[model samples]
Target: MFTLPFSALALSLCASAASALNSKRHASLAQRIKSEQPALRSPVWHGLGRDTNFQITDNCTGSTFFDCFDYFTDADPTHGDVVFVNESDAWSLGLVSTTPTQSFLRVDNSTSLPSGQGRNSVRLGTKKTYDGALFVLDVEHMPFGCATWPAFWTVSQTQPWPLGGEIDIVEGVNLNPLNQMTLHTGPGCAPNTSASDYTGQQLGTTCPSSDGANAGCGFLDRSNTSYGAGLNAAGGGVFAMHWDGGGVSIWHWTHDEQPCDLADLSGSPDPSGWGTPAAAWVANGCSPYTYLTDHQAIIETTLCGDWANSNYAAAGCPGTCSDAVMDPSNFNDAYWQINYFSVFVES
Candidate 1:
């Protein structure tokens, strides 16, 4: 989850602490598993389960745009220096707009605020919640810039924090060239041997959000064109996330590279024909029902939050995150031009 409301450095330190404790407590089990499985496996995605036919349940596009989501006006959970305005303010400030072909959610790139004031932005979340379903995000452009943290994610709607779970499908900070997919949940959930059976590079195998270390299981998509400036230049395409009893799979494709099935979203979606996904977290043993449920999808752009602030210097961006926010031009490209957000369920 991108917005766990904790500092990234703190999370890393907490994870290290948890790891140390786990190492002492589960040494034997860890050793056994290490011996049983190879440290590295093939990068190819193995079809663990066949895809099911899907029918569109809710499609947010065109005239029904504003009706599909609610503008979140609360303070940012990630502590970003952003002010999330309500629907009226969003429209009045030009932070949100919609057309028959596209909908826009953007940071206030034209107004330079006071030195300490947060930038005006919009965070929109779906009104409907989902348990196990297929989510398709068709975008034309995504937010990106120094100190900008943009994410398209889902968190449990009914449970408290990590108890339910959070899934970050499209997330990245600063000028990162690749997309990150992560899961933040409680204990008793970890990846199996087949966890590496995806195109993306696996960052972690554990999926717990305890000890203040929301460093859940994560994968990094290898494609440079999967996010940031490259994604905008290539003309954004489809990002599909399949979540069910079997597991979770994420796929990303540039507009020119998208599969034929996605070309016409009106037809039923079959993941089996979509080829290997960009990332996959197979259940093998991890129970989706127990760890993840009743999630509401979200799209937001924040500034100098937990992740972005911690990695500010490392990303080689100029000045402080605060400094970047004061410059209106810094966020000119920090916007999401979305074509549609559609949820599909098994037929």
Candidate 2:
């Protein structure tokens, strides 16, 4: 695994800390909106198509979490210090549950194990595969504690990895306040971030795994409320990714900043009116239709993975990721509170 120098990592951490302070200010604004506009609050959309232009394929809620996702109990492919548990084990350990409208997915928060690999957790993948579509996620809380690496991403099931492409919509490690969206693909695939109207800072232009650091093509959202603690403070938010024949675009709207159409969910989402995306990847050298296909949605929280381990000390955590992750007290806040997940296809 490749790593950045301590000096660079320190700079990144400082920047994230500044973002956290700003997010606190936005959280207060969101709270005022909630108090003043009670009528704007609406439950997550759980039914099918509301308009003729889009068809809903998956309407995942707290009640449907287990039914819609397949338990991925296998070993961590990213070499994280985690043991993924089966469906029965997860529920028996109180690591997964559902209330009326929200779903809770959590890590093992009761046991203090030895400082070897780490404690057990849950990883879930959607059973349905998609070619091209719009994915919208309404989340109330996300895993944000130290040593936690939470991600909401989509990957193709092709062998050798990155052949079909991987789109990371929401991903961050350690105590990162800002979200990092990335694209990993086989050779010859690169994104023209400069040509697109995205608000994030593009770390790299090429997405080929052959890049020495395997950094891929990454864009870092500067908003502190885009991930982790800042996100939860803002009452969570909506993440929408539209992938089609042309390219892929991702947009984020905090609870107080959601568009009227998204807030109401009365009809199909209109991305044309959503303005500039946080990150937009236009296929400059590769064909998006041919390179990105047969992908399934995945939501997981792993501990001490490659990225998290690389920046553990820089993030000012207590100790090494493996050691801290085994302590049950450290992960008290490590959990996913999802309101709903919906996929819309063009009609």
Candidate 3:
């Protein structure tokens, strides 16, 4: 054995101890960070852009929800950074009604829009600049009332209408949270049953249920508050949707709450957890066509008619487009607030 002076041995031991301590400190930091906001391990899709503009709701152009000929945000779209307002509650912003034969937006701007837009019309720019695993949008609150439909949604830039795929982040009727995650394609839409929707990952692919299915396929998910309440962009929560080519899923996260992960949705997406696709979406026309590969922008505010028009009482609901759904009596006068619209890619 090599003998060493007492002073030398003490110095060597001290150096080793210091090194070990530093390693432990570093490990601790890594753990803390992991717990706070874990990194996206299998992040297939990612957010291409993000903005936290406090003044996003500073433009106007569309018509009100009260017998207006045009929308308020028509002339001034507020660009990519601007949040289009209803302006004067006169232009319906082109939003038509879908049910009960009425079209409206209840002119109200508590968040930012001095001007109100309603039913299927209102723009905050588009997700056109981004393309990846998927796109997620979080908005303030959706307008609610009979025939009142608000949505935080997306549309394909390359393809139009059903071909491109319509992702309705928030869609409901009456004053309920029957928030729905639907994929509209071809002639068939709204699969009506959990089994019809073929979305396996989010719906439970562990084993097909007794119904001989891969979980609800189409418009999976239906709920009032428990699930819907937590997902309404109106109340301010993370009503996020996932899309990465062959997969699609919707998640509802409450304020300051972590979102339910794939494991949580292991079972058949709760009864209301993006429950199942609608009945019409299961037919051959709709199945195997829910992947949105080319949407221009992500709709982050409340939209009426275009998707939430209820049952189509407005002139534009069934067909005619020129009969503007603008009316000044109704307005949401609300501004959609965002913490951060971020995107993460799968590495």
Candidate 4:
């Protein structure tokens, strides 16, 4: 989710087949937050050679996963009904844990809290920041339920947001069956849609983080199993974000379809062999080097923020967004089981 200053954009711009479907499923909130903003694969180089190889720089995995990330204990910038807990609290509350095989991130699903008190959850960002790289995430399960919002993304930690840019690799609210890929950048930057090639369907053309209340350009994945319940049912998958001089692209592969090169963190990854990406932002209009840089990978699950609150009824979920948070049983499946996250850069 983007955490930039909000300015209202046309509700029509937010219109999409998915939203239309949501409209049919759930009723809209009284007032919507318009700022909700919401990739890929091949190694074939535009200016660089096809021989370009990406080597793993940071392989965050296993029991040490906790040490690789910093707990974000601050207030939810999206104003979700969540209290971002510190590492200590996160451990005690069972919000985060690491094992030899994977890491687990979960929100408090047992405690029925009073009104206005956000539930306990964990938000984490990698300690290392990168200007440009290939990010590969191996996921086994992700949070899902009414009023739940989960995302895996990258945003700059060194510069003010939109200045450094934001790239959402996997994001969705409620029981969204597909993933939404998006890019957020400052003014003067818009994706070259004509030149960009991808498999996912584009929702909006411009990438301005402000013009559309930070709606930023968004694209919805075509795979039914790319997100939420469908993703979990398919036994999870791999999400890759490739950001470099050419531009940024994202790809999603189900558990069985993941490329062999990506299976081994020790080997170099070749995107050229990965096929068409789900979403791509060509450098013709937006330069990745200029707009997207020095970013840390982020992972978290928030409840009933601007996007979820407004789209609550559309998902066919009962009650207001805040009310949904009070029911502990509503979040029985609210959790993330991650295999590993590997950052690769051109060698």
TM per candidate: 0.84, 0.83, 0.44, 0.86
Local accuracy of candidate 3 as per-residue lDDT tens digits, 1-347: 11111123334554565587566666667775665342322222122112211111111112211222223365422122122455343344433321222223332332233333333334444412334333333333445443344455555666655555655555543344455555544333333233333322233212111222212233434334322334443254545454443244555544433222211222111212233222122222233334344654443333333333333343223332112224323334323333333333333
Q: Supply the global lDDT for candidate 3.
A: 0.36
For residues 187-295, write the lDDT of model 1, one tens digit per residue: 7887573644688888887788965588898989999888989888877767999888777889998765665456556567667655667777777668788889899
Mark the 10 consecutive residues where model 2 has the least summed lDDT.
Answer: 40-49
CA RMSD of all predictions: 13.6, 12.1, 17.0, 14.4
Give the per-residue lDDT of model 2 (tens digit) for 83-179: 9999999999999999867899998988988868567899999989888899988888899888899999998975457788889999998889899
The Cα local distance difference test for each model comes to 0.81, 0.78, 0.36, 0.81
Task: Give me the runs in candidate 4 sitting further than 4 Å from their true place.
Answer: 1-44, 48-50
Stretches of candidate 2 off by over 4 Å are: 1-52, 210-212
Model 1 lDDT, residue 260, Cα: 47
Model 4 Cα lDDT, one tens digit per residue, 1-347: 11111112212322343476466555444323332211243332476544787776777776877888999988888889998899999998888888887889998989998898898888999999999999988888899999899999999887887788999999999977889999998778876655347889998876877532877898999999899999999888889999988888899987667665665444567787677788888887888888887899999999999888888898898878898898888888999998888788998
Displacement of residue 267 (Cα, Å) in model 3 is 27
Candidate closer to the true structure by TM-score (higher is better), 1 or 3: 1
Best by TM-score: 4
